[model samples]
Target: MRLPTLASTVERRLLVNYRVDPPAISRLLPAALRPQLVAGYAVAGICLIRLGNVRPTWAPKAVGLRSENAAHRIAVEWDGPDGIQTGVYIPRRDTGSRLNTWAGGRIFPGEHHIADFQVHETGKELHVSYTTRDDATRVEIAATVDDDLHDSRLFSNLEQVSAFFRRGSAGYSATKTGHHLDGMRLDTRRWQVTACQAQRATSTFFENPDRFPPGAATFDCALLMRDIPARWHSLPAMPVETDVSGSVPSDARM
Candidate 1:
């Protein structure tokens, strides 16, 4: 049985975002979802996170598990029965924990691939890199905490960027079945973020030319969250509408 909620400590999270041409992002999303635009540009990114003390809400903290994870996501919105709803659509998930890979789609939300991760952190800086076991994905970033958003064309300031993401806490993940999306929501009581400057960043998923044509995507800004208490809740799955081909594109799977 799936747990109602899982509690965890957000040891670290880095959102390395990109601004992409709207049309390019549209092709990859299922028909039910449309890219959520900012300044007429679609937003996509890699979320590199490290979670500690993760366990069912009823369990003691001492039994919690820790893991390093990554997700490739796109900001999206869809027509809900109530109105327009906003969230993120995750195409792929990777983790260093075997337990996460085994329990993800079965007990939580998305299916996860096993990956190897290298991480180094200090008070002011962070460096992380990972590669999936199948060699289908790789990502790396070196960033430092900063006081202001740097060279971001999407949002005018750090506050605006932070608020934008806070509003899109719900995320849907693509499932192997392709007929529906697995959903989850992140809850944090003391929500806080700091602007970060990525001195170096790379993502094979975003950099693939076959998926994103030349000049379609560009680096934006990064945000960092550290030492936060959080909870994860599963949501009802949403049915998807696929194209007439009756199959999701291979490029959609990492």
Candidate 2:
């Protein structure tokens, strides 16, 4: 049985986002999910987060877990009971915590890979780098946080972009078991963001020729968030509608 909700303290969360070719983004998503478009392109990015005091809401913070984590996510939409739902589809997640890596998907909504991480923060500058132990995935970034949104192209302005993600509280991730996607919702008391300049960034998954041709994905923008309080709740399995256009399997597993 899934817990009602899990509470955690967000020590730090930095999102380094990119605007990729919609078709390219679509290729990466399961058939049950379609890319959530912005100005005709797909949105994808990496999230570097540190969570503290993580445990069931009914539990005490003193017994909570602290961990460093990252996720490769794509903005996506899928069929929903009310209508189409907007959220993120996470293809991969990595963490430095042993428990999360071991019991993910089995006891949690998503499965995690054990990875090493290097992080640094100074004033408004955020730098983070990580790679899976198997070396199959890599993400690195050095960005300077700012309040400018005039340079953004995906959204008309920063507020629009912030609101977009604020509403996308739901996320689907690969489960440890087979191809099943476990749903999870991040409930936060507030939604906030600050634009950033990507001094340098790289994503091997999007760079893979097997996945995307050159120019399919280009770095668009970055966002930063500091300390926040949040809760995570387990959701039911997604209702994916299958189609014949190079779609994912009817019984889609992570």
Candidate 3:
């Protein structure tokens, strides 16, 4: 299906970043896409967002939907016909709205799993938590609004990190066989992000010592944005070659 453009209010967004080993990042990326490195290490993270009043461009605002969604994303770039394309590669998507899971794969890219979410905001502080239906993924973020980055190895400062993600508005989702890149782009009039201090944060996926190893993955920085007008638009899937012979057929993967 052709991707559709969605309009909504980014009621809240928690961007928790992690710096991972280049090799670890490589294992997660699909064909053509490479981790957008900072300094030398690869970047990856969890994008937990609360979207409000979401609806199709042509639909009435009164009929919009709201949901809490999370994506495990990797900062990636690839060589395209035009030049180098920078964006994110999403491995999994979990949403509180069951409608999203139902429409996935048909109305849009297939979603990975459905999960319940809890969000609480107290002045400049916020806490968001969630777990998948099967309990495979569990995450939590307790943070306070701030203008300081406590720790980061990938970029020198917050601006450097923000600037990198600003140009990476485009994103692709991985398929089951890890061959196809389902495409999507984030549309925002402007990026207004603030630095955040993570009082405590955890993600089972990135915190796995065996997978990320010691020093391989560590907390870089956290950012928060609120009340931003944005849109989600579909893009053509990027086909990758599995070998030197030719492009891998779409249906052949899964």
Candidate 4:
């Protein structure tokens, strides 16, 4: 059957304000992490806090599955000296299922560290709680995910590169399959490196941007990291698993 489009029905609310100062950010991060920062703008960093309710028109029996009725989500974005980072916090129960096979085995494919999240709803507001690493820094994202934004096509191209990187297989290449954005191109490359860490999860790193056709600017280098919840393997066959602890698995290997 045809699944109803929750994309159009999803609603967003602004709960907390996000803030970041470029100078303050520069002073906070280590020198090795600076290259990931986006340049040409003084704004350098951003903070974002959003509260939104989503109602899916249908429901499935698997875990981590999005409900067809309604649910809530809070997402944050931040830019810092190391790189641009974003996190979305979704209360565990809001998701009807716990299996996230849609990740295509790229994430949450096995059992690992997962935690119960708590969210409280009062009138039109929802309260959420989460924790970050002690040494790890947190920055608020200033950018917003546009309601009408549809970049799945672009993301798909990026994912192709991400998949190859995850396997640690060499001699792969990415070419521009298509372009939905002006400055972005679909890239396929060879000799990509897959780096996986216990606490950092898995990522594919590309050393050269010139492998693909020339665009207005070269990406220089690119990396795709997969962020999957730890308890993925324990609860198999579910649509989604919500008990995310914001921590990568302890056993991830390169």
- Best of the candidates, TM-score: 1
Q: Highest lDDT: give the candidate number.
A: 1
Clash number for each model: 0, 4, 0, 47
Off by over 4 Å in 2: 176-178, 239-254
Residue-by-residue lDDT tens digits, candidate 3, 1-254: 68678899999988999888898768655567788888887888999999898888889889989889998888888988899888988877888989988876657664557998988987699899999998878999999998766677676777877888888888787676555667888899979888898988899878777566777788888988899989988889787658675545332232
TM-score of 3: 0.91
> Each candidate's lDDT (Cα)?
0.91, 0.81, 0.81, 0.21
The window of 10 residues in a row where model 1 has the poorest summed lDDT is 245-254
| Candidate 2 TM-score, true structure as reference | 0.92
Root-mean-square deviation of Cα positions for candidate 3 versus the true structure, in angstroms: 3.3
Model 4: lDDT to the true structure = 0.21
Per-residue lDDT over 1-254 for candidate 1, one digit per residue giving the tens place of the 0 to 100 score = 34478999999999999999999999888788899999999999999999999999999999999999999999999999899999999989999999999998787888899999999999899999999999989999999999999789999999999999999899999888888888999999988999999999998888889889978999999999999999999989888776688887654544
Cα deviation in Å at residue 121, candidate 3?
A: 1.5
- Reference-based TM-score of each model: 0.97, 0.92, 0.91, 0.24
Q: Over 4 Å off in model 3, which ranges? A: 243-254
What order do candidates take by TM-score, descending? 1, 2, 3, 4
The sequence of per-residue lDDT tens digits that candidate 2 reaches over residues 1-254 is 57468899888888777888887777667777899888988998888999999998999999999999998889899877799999998888999888998877666688888888999888788888888897978888998978676566788877888898887889898654434577899999877787888889897877878777888888888888777899998888664444555345422332
Name the lDDT of candidate 3: 0.81
Candidate 2 lowest-lDDT run of ten = 245-254
